[model samples]
Target: MPNNKIGGHYSQAYDEELQQAVDRLVDMGGLVLQQLRDSMAAFTTADVVLAKQVKKGDRQVNSFEVDIDEHCLDILARRQPAATDLRLVLSVLKSINDVERIGDQAKRIAKTLLKDEQGSRPSAEQLAELNGMSAKVQLMLQHALLAFQQIDADKALNVLREDKAIDDDYSRIMQQSLSAMMHDSQQISVSLQISNVAKALERVGDHSRNICQHAIFLSKGRNVAHLNDDELQQIVEKKRD
Candidate 1:
């Protein structure tokens, strides 16, 4: 396992910079989490005002990505970090991109809600699978961010495991939406909108899993993104001799 502590550099300033990068990243994660939560709430309640707010919040998330990228680049230029330190910077760089994309997915969900015509709300039965998927992806996102904050490979692996469930849920929702569309041609428009929201939630799960993969890379110094579940379990469980 990699070092959990981040501030043992001989250069005190270098240590501070690394810590600052982590702090900012955690802050960004928190914002994105709330963005997703609010977007889902807006969807469930058909709250146009909240959906509008979630859409507007995407700008701040984009700004966070740009700021974090600049900070990581500064570290790479000045510190030229190697080994674990290099992994830390590189993981932060990769993680921020996923976090920003998660934010974008949230914005897409919000946009789907906002675009619905008046009196075109989807019934709760139609939204059931979507609601389930929203909850799971939110939990996955929360755990993935926590894994990065704590540098816990086990937690990252758990997030990876949950990703397959999200994929399954997405497939189920698509099938249900298609069935609804086929049964009632008039339901096609509403079914299509629900499909869009489900797709956004699925993408959110994917982005969250990507963040977890970066966490694993940071902790293990191994890229586990393309690994099968069994292979990932083995890599994360193996101890250095």
Candidate 2:
């Protein structure tokens, strides 16, 4: 994703700076992925300690967003990057915001899990559904970040396709949880918590899609923001044509 041609001025310092920015972005992505994993594990195990740690780790994710944005701004001001280089920086800036929000969503899941220690927890079947949803979301983010790193538009589109499955899973989880709550009045609080977690997982998929959208923008320079599935597929088809 590093563009070497910026008005033909290929300073070593500029190249290093740009590369470092991308490295930070990758690091940030990895950190959020870990946060998601830890948060889900904490919830499933009902480990208050791990949940607390996940909540505390959100600060590091926030820091990475701030640092990366500053570096991008510095490059824009000093290097005045153009063409692909400019696109790279802009995409990184936008994608990092999504990554940070993913971390926040993970943190929210952890907080919800830890909200009530004395109350009943989710049933095993519910946890399995939640874990499945989390796995899909985690994979989506993983692919999105890889696509971002490689500036691979096809990979980004594939991530978009995966989002639909996750959405379906989220809807199924919500339905199951709601049905369980209706059967047992005591299950209301725990069911609500699971619903919130499912919603957070769905939002994570959304943020991952946003990252992939930025990747597409970086690769094709065709601002595919806010487009639906069919529309995005049409754009890809047009590019292929």
Candidate 3:
């Protein structure tokens, strides 16, 4: 049955405005993604100017949060959309906080790197690995946001699966940093910064997982996180069988 109970809804003329709002939210997500990537770049290159740019970007992303919140509230107050329509508004309202905090984590990473006295880069191999992990998490975030907007469960599931790979990558980074720390007393400070950055990347991976989880919940009413990959694969196999 089609929902026909819309109250005080804007006419068809407002469809474009509503879509623009969603686009702006996605744009906000994009900005955060770039910040995360650039933060890592700043840390890896010991570029204080890059870190400063990231800090500046933090303020801008916060403004996006505020603007999106106001627009969502306006939609709610005026349209009073119910059911899935209401759900979309509320889920976005909730998800933006996670996105904003992800930006904050990037800011923290930038600040930490800016404090480095030696201005050294992380080892080439280690930096490459970290870059790979960062790319994965960033892509997952982008896919999750797109999935939310498009109600694409398959894309959401892919984002969920990608988290494990990010975790595995971070684990290796941790082990390597820990080994480096244990071997050289003089390297203690650098090792500490490296370990913390790895942990922050791991945290961002967790947030990506959370975003995908909510995407599944909002779009399909599925709680995908409760199942392990093997268990989930089995569930899918059985359904196909």
Candidate of highest TM-score: 1
**Per-model TM-score versus the true fold:** 0.95, 0.94, 0.85
- Summarize candidate 3's per-residue lDDT along 65-84 as a digit string, tens digits: 99999988998898786766
Greater-lDDT candidate between 2 and 3: 2
Candidate 2 lDDT at 107 equals: 97
Q: List the residue pairs that clash in candidate 3.
A: none
lDDT of candidate 3 vs native?
0.76
lDDT of 2: 0.89
The per-model lDDT (C-alpha) reads 0.88, 0.89, 0.76
> Residue 157 in candidate 3 has what lDDT?
72
Report the alpha-carbon TM-score of model 2 versus the true structure: 0.94
Among all candidates shown, the one with the greatest lDDT: 2
